[model samples]
Target: MLRSRVAAAGGCVAALGLAAALAAGAPASATDRTDPNDRYTAEEIHHFLEGFYGNHGPRPWEREHLVSDRLKERIAQTPGYDLLLCAQNEPRDIEVGEVTTAQSARVGWATITTHWSQSPRTAAFTAYVDLDGSRPLQLLDVDCAPGD
Candidate 1:
């Protein structure tokens, strides 16, 4: 459930935004679906990354248009704590931490602690969703380091 929500809000935004910008440059007959879900893929998520610098650096505009404070706040307001407690799939052994979300037009960021997985390794991740809300995917750095 955490993966689903985070992926939807984060990765989907970046992918959708890039899709929109690219779509405008393409011919009108382009067959790609505008829906964000259409672009979502595990592979895309695994390799896709927005650089922090350069011409195509991870600028704010790309992600700003795709996500909203309303959405993030709504997620923050969810009963995530409760879900972690009662959900059988969620490991009950470790103390869970508060959930937080960050947004750019092209991405959403989330970090939380869970006992189900190894320590520190899976504590946080960034989802890069396209502007169209297409199939957003979670991306971890190549070094297995946590993303900003």
Candidate 2:
């Protein structure tokens, strides 16, 4: 699926000085995990997806580390694409666009399209979160591309 693959090669490093250049460079209190208001917001989803798709690291307050091992391995073996000025350079600045949520007997999730890269590259994600408020947000799936 597109979502799963989004976590794949987006994390690779490149040739020449590009790799080193790309290698360069938050939070609230809460044991209130049980609090009803402690639901997963787009902020949390974007933070998680940032790591999953952009090859970025996890943000603070994230409960689990979710980078896929296969993705990591692929990134290591393949040359990373350095063309994403917005995606690779200032990934954190990328914003979450539209967000919608749903649940089934099996799972609950939020479907989102993020402003991800610059003018073109964008991402769609289905991130699952615990509505019962016992756990933190997780990316059930994610897909990214260069245009609409």
Best candidate per TM-score, number? Answer: 2
Give the alpha carbon lDDT tens digit for every residue of 27-133 in model 1.
53212533244333333332333222112222355334333445444435555432212222444233212222222334432233334444543233333333323
- Model 1 root mean square deviation, Cα atoms: 18.3
Regions of candidate 2 where Cα sits further than 4 Å from its true position: 1-92, 105-132, 146-148
Q: What's the number of clashes in each of the models?
A: 34, 1
lDDT of 2: 0.41
* TM-score, prediction 2: 0.34
lDDT of each: 0.36, 0.41
Q: Residue 12 error for model 1, in Å?
A: 36
Any runs in candidate 1 off by more than 4 Å, and if so which? 1-39, 46-48, 51-58, 68-124, 128-148
